[model samples]
Target: MTENKDKQPAAEEKAKERNWISASLWADKEDIRKGAERYGEVKWYKSARFWPSMLVLILTWIGAAVTGSYSEAVGVSVILCPLCYLNVKGYRWSLLLFAALYTFDRVSVLYMRAESGQASGSGLWWLLIWWLVIVGATLTAFRIENYRHKHNLAGRGHYVKDTLIALAFPVVLIASFMAYNIFMYKSSLTDEQRKALAFSYGFISRNTDGVINYCLRSGVELQKFPEQFRQTYADEITKVNDWLEKDEIFKSGMEASLQENKEMLYEVFENGRKDLIRLTIAEETGEKPENLVWKTEYDRMISPVEYCKLMDESFEIMNSTGFFDSFVETVKTLQ
Candidate 1:
């Protein structure tokens, strides 16, 4: 106990003078010259504050990847801490210049998204929002870095010790949080239910069978409609609805994929029926259909790319005319 008490005062005394950068920031040129002679350059990499921010950034990405979600990934702004440290203490304009360049690149992506029906809102509005986020983040980072450097709260240490200590908190927190969630999730299911879910997952993921099943099963089921010559797809409605309502990420993609496949399947059916009539006419009359009838007889022998255009056009027709829901009623009576 006496040894511990003796060490405490000495440790506190060392801590007071440990912030070399802050101590030297206001000292004379001669003091800085002497300190550099002993400690070398005070790089941002030496900042304990910078290391912790980097640790947060790295853990956020790992969380996103493990959860199969993007919210944590979006938290990569935590990295701005160290970058800000680099700029304010080293080259003040570097962050601003990099921001301008990155904004220009992202603008092209945002514009392309707007054109592809993937993004909402006006181009000007989107540009304003992005700039707001970027500018706000840059300024916040600058303030944080300024505070860290000015106080020299970022104490120096061996790189390995600094890195391990910086990473310890986030790693422990995320690991425990994820572990608890996993345990609660598992407890919510019965062993039988879990096995059944595993089986269903395998059935649904007939292609990969790797880890997760990613096929648009609902869309595929919907596409099997009238072509379900063996059995109509009307029966799959419950499964598809359950699948869609169970998850929004799945639900959002469901509509577009279902729309595409629905058009393709429906058009393929119509074209097949029309060609069947022509084939019967040819067989009965012993002659190919004439040019005027040829247009209705053949589907233009389109390539896959051309077929996509036709399907997209067909979706507009089927959707606007209410053919999709009404056609389901017809198939429901297939008994």
Candidate 2:
């Protein structure tokens, strides 16, 4: 009887040693082992809420699969599937992991919306719904974990490291994503598109003046291409020359007027600037104020002489590129 008592004690110690070794490894495996010992072979299906929580997760996954791109879906699955398994098996650290992912995702979406200055009510509602569902699923996992603890079925492990790792995941993932983009990036623009964009940028760079406002004040109808062409290349060149002549006349008029009314022009410019500042503020704040329009042509008031010089340079650039000749040739090819 004495020997039997000694052996029983030794066996119990061995069992405890085994349990400790199991628990120290990974929480999910430990939970399953303990749960199986206490709640029969079908340990995972012990809780009534388990299936429901898992159903929510599965549906969320399906939603992502349907809505997201292939790469995004795969990425989400890699991170989410393991969390789902661990969470269902009663890992509370999974909550922190899920929360980290959720925060990153929501923040990214909000930032994009802020940048674009547009977000539909329906889109926001859907995001809210997604958040609520995640919270609900999280609460479900907490309850299961609590139940495991109460039943002496929960895994014994220090989760501090796990929580810290969960927190670091977003940072790592973001860094990896940025690195991938930096290294693997390729331009999607065609050669023609690139050339067209380059030409547009050139014009934009040379546009020091508010050309629309200048044309409005000068009574100059800027020459339109092809549509305004008079059935011959020579006629088109004449039209361009006429437009340039009108621009010169407008510049001469501005210079002479500046000589006469320099101080008056300065006052007009300052007042126009104040009006523009007020207008910009009102627009940004979504407020409409009376007399928001500039009292004078604010754009024309500041550096009218410089504006004429820039316009001449812009014309020179347009002509120097053989743009007119190439456009005519392209149109002829189409014919």
Candidate 3:
């Protein structure tokens, strides 16, 4: 009977050891393991709420990554968010900080760039705003759940064991995100697509302004033949320009719009798509892109001054993004 009692304790210890992987996530759980002030502490991980909290944290981590610009606040917020699951108090505090940091990062990016989202015009800020809505919903739901049925877990305390436990969550979150991205890239992207992506990044390096928001590209994805691609871009531009000279559909609209706008319209490229040189004009003039209605194959749209600077040896942007993008799109639509 004594041997059976000894074996029972040994088996229990082994079971705890097995769960230590996930059990390390809890503040009170670790305190109990270390024989600290953790009497009567429940194994909260056994609660179904704990798993749901973990799932939510994982989703938040991904959302932060998707909307993040290359900023320190973004990195910190992404890493720290997952660990918020470590303790309920920590979860609330950490997520609030993340929301603040995300706002800071988004605003800072807009501030740092000469082009404000509203004034200079961008959809990237809208993307950030969308994430805010999602995160806000998540937080609101959390509050409702907490209010209705509190988990009543102890808050985080200053202990090396707990600190280490909290830190591991972020490390895992980051590593998992990276792995997921790599896997997605490898599995989903074709060789041509990846080459196009690389060319897009290369354009960022060459541009004097040096804004290569990875999420947005200048509608160019040329990879097969640069020389031929360039010629195709030129040819398409000629067609568009020629059409502009002759077409009345555009002329009546352009004349009326230009009278008010007074700026040369150019193609503003975005995430694998095109926007407008003047955002309001398209809506203001009641102009919509007709299928095959656009005569221009040209994709790179910049001001005359910016275009001049791009070709200048000093600026070093040689229209690679636009040229390649035009070629690929032309092949898809026309060829």
Candidate 4:
């Protein structure tokens, strides 16, 4: 009985020792083991995780290359490599790394959008998706580590070392590629090109406003003209209407005009004045009749006199031949 009692104490001591691992040290050890396993799996490219991840990476590269977006391909490749490594090894730190990298990548996209003066709505959507994936992967890693701890898995130290090595390699590759791009493919736009682009945007804005105003006034005037006038002017009015529908400049102009007027002219005249003036002058009469002439004489015939004056002012503002020449010169300077 004494011998059995002594043996029981020794067995209890061994059990206590086994359960008494320092939490911090054990966590570090588990991390290292997970990393090493991930590294080995990635390096061999033989794990189940490898095939799908590699397939995605290859497909992304091919798609980006086809679209002539090499930068996108490189970025995707960088992201995919680490993702694959993490999935195979199931490291907690891999999830953290993914989250950090994803955040950094999204910030870069935001910066690019700001530089171009564009909305980042789509970018935000993409970032949200990435965040979800990172979070899901992290939770998966935590579950996996818990399983490993329960199982008392061996060679955790080797696994951790492997994961770190795997992570280091791809990181270096991505950094080198970025450095090369920064050093080699710098784009420096000339002053003239910048000015020309500014002028082009301004010209586009002004013309759009003019087009909208002309369409609205013409539609109103046409509606006021006789039915014969509407038929006679059908083709010309149709051409103008088509231009209003298809021309981006005209559409922009109409939008601008509607905004300026605080009136919904765009909604009213969306279909344009197809039912308006069809007036035709009788060639035999040779009389300077008061029928609504669709010719340049209609400009002189414009009433309220103020509208005519405004039309004239618009024409003068839009008719800067020197400005056009300067715009062309600016484009040349860019080249």
Candidate 5:
């Protein structure tokens, strides 16, 4: 019985040794003291006081000039000390200063919005909420720092959680900004309004899709159309121009149709420009005009005026065949 008791004591000692080693490993893994070394080194900058502060002030001025938000830049600068308080001395004073700066910024934004006759909506509410979050996060970070001073809690898992909480405000602010941009894009236009705007911008064309595809396939063919073919195309275009000039109904109908398909026209124009270079190259290669490659190339090399003429003729042909409306609708639904 005595021998067994003695062996049990030795086993306990071994377990204790193992536990101590494990704890030492954890301490090494999560050493906040090593991380704080950079904070300690920042004392030299703090000692320089006026010069460093003035540099930040100058940087704020530069940011204001660049961004056209002087008040915001100044507000950010005023709050910088509190934001960096985790790595600096006089953290309490910095926190107070930051709170004051935030209050001033809120008042200024409200005043500006009022002056501009803009409603104080989600953006203003978000700014207020963000300020509250910043205050809460700053205080939490300070409390954590104070707790670490009294107890060795700095290297624990809780410390990492606290660090994440401290980062949450900035992350939320960035996310809100992104959400606002997306909302603006979606809510700025109605379906009919968007279609009308696109049409007015020059998107209407009976052969827009085929032309765009042809251009994409053989942009170089546009350049290959001999000067004679261009003249023929031009003469055909002039004939339509003369007809539109003489017929008010035809002219008005053409304008209305174009207004409806403006977006498609813009897309085609942009796409055609890209295809022009390719069309020029294809023309030099003697590709047939009716070939997809040649047609695409030809469309790309055609000027806006020429393209409009082609589209008008195509629209007239489609209308005579009773497919103009269907064709326009189909092109409208495409990119």
Candidate 6:
């Protein structure tokens, strides 16, 4: 009888431990309902997770507004506002969403830098630290939610006020940035500079993607029509370039547009060069290439020099097509 009494206490102790573990590790509807009854709906707003997330959210918006990344800022705001709301309201899945977003954004940034041949250097370390902080913050948020559930201090409130407040950050920041752009930046520009900027935008909208698409689609037959295609394309480009070269405004606008998008241009040309190499090797090995290679009906692989020349001419010809007379008329209207 005494032994049975001792065992009964031991079993009770084990049960308590199990209950504690479940409460800390899991949150179901019942526990949340009980928490709401115990602590009321506003419990989430008072959470340690809530204020810090808010601070970080506001700081992020501020950073974006200060930098020239207005569009990116607006995009992040749209994505994060709802996540922030759900997170503060004790939804555990919000933490997962946060981690996933941070990972994708950072990885894409790194990939773009590498693609552009920008050295990571110390920036990589900063990115590593940033990733670590994101992971740590997410884990901490999960722990906070768990703690609240364990203590019956968490509840999913209507959070209408919280939602409005969260959404206001992005809305206000975007509006402010737009006002600054229109009143400050645009107003500061001279008439000539404004015209140049407009011309630059028009030129890129007309030429850049069309040139890239043409390069990716068209191929030069260096053996059969080598001199013929090259000569004709060069003549067309020379005519357009020569006509535009006389105008100072056109030169400035074209230079600025090209420089601004040099990375994209470089990527297109580099990929084309790689495709040519891949096609050449595939022919030699009698194996299929992994990617589509641009080739003419002749389907003959050429030397690297010939490939480079072909790409150069293609870029110039595609950029020059229909742009010469169209932009000449555009320039006249601007004047």
- Between 5 and 6, whose TM-score is larger? 6
Query: What C-alpha lDDT values do all the predictions have?
Result: 0.43, 0.48, 0.41, 0.47, 0.44, 0.55
Candidate 3 residue lDDT tens string, 1-335:
99999999997796567442333333243323332223134354542224334544455557645643223233553555444454343344554555565466567656534231132445566756555553553344234334333444434455666667777766775776456445543234344543443343233222312222211123222222333333545565444334333322232343344323311122222212333333323556566533224324434454433433233322213344353464345333321
Encode model 6's per-residue lDDT on 1-335: one tens digit a residue.
Answer: 99999999997686556442243234345544443444434356544335434545676779865743345555577777667777766677777777787788779878755544453589888877767665555555576566677776766566687667767867776777567555654124446645644664444433434343333333322232224333534544444444443343344455556647755665665566667677777888786878545456423555445564565555446446753455444444432
TM-score of 4: 0.34
- Give the candidate order by descending TM-score: 6, 4, 2, 1, 3, 5
Prediction-by-prediction clash tally: 0, 0, 4, 21, 29, 0
Candidate 2 RMSD to the correct structure: 20.3
Worst 10 residues of 2 by lDDT: 201-210
Q: Name the regions of candidate 2 deviating beyond 4 angstroms.
A: 1-68, 155-335
The candidate, 4 or 6, that scores higher on lDDT is 6
lDDT by residue (1-335, candidate 1, tens digit) is 99999999997786566464344323344333344343335455443223333444565578767755442344234334434444434332445644664466568667644433345467667666655555444433344444445656434435565445435645655665456445643234344433443333322222121100111211221232123211433354444334333333333343334333543444444554455556766777788854226663254443333433344335446446764554344333322
The clash number for model 5 is 29
Tell me how far the alpha carbon of residue 96 in candidate 4 is from the true structure, in angstroms, after superposition.
2.8
Instruction: Give the Cα error of residue 323 in candidate 3, in Å.
Output: 16
Candidate 3 off by > 4 Å: 1-78, 87-91, 112-125, 128-131, 138-162, 170-204, 207-335
Q: By TM-score, how accurate is candidate 5?
A: 0.24
Q: Extract clashing residue pairs from model 2.
A: none
Candidate that beats the other on TM-score, 3 or 4, i.e. the better one: 4
**How do the residues 1-335 of candidate 4 rate in per-residue lDDT, one tens digit apiece?**
99999999997675446321221123345444553344344343533224445555687788866754455566677666867676556555654555566567667767644433343588678766655544443444454455555666523545767667677867887788667655654353344534444454343433343333444443322222223323533453344334333333333444444345433433332212211212224333454444534554543433323342343344334334353354344434433
TM-score of each: 0.32, 0.34, 0.31, 0.34, 0.24, 0.44
Q: Report lDDT (Cα) of residue 112, candidate 5.
A: 45
- Predicted structure 5: lDDT: 0.44
Error of 2 at 292 (Å): 27
Best by lDDT: 6
Candidate 5 residues 1-335, lDDT tens each? 99999999997686556432232223232232332333244333432212223344466689768744443443454345324522234243444555566567667767645433343588788767655554443443344344455455444334455445545645664565446445533233445534443342232232433243333333222332233223434443343334333333334445556545545655665565546545566678776434534345444366655654454445445456764354345334432
The candidate, 3 or 5, that scores higher on lDDT is 5
Global Cα lDDT for candidate 3: 0.41
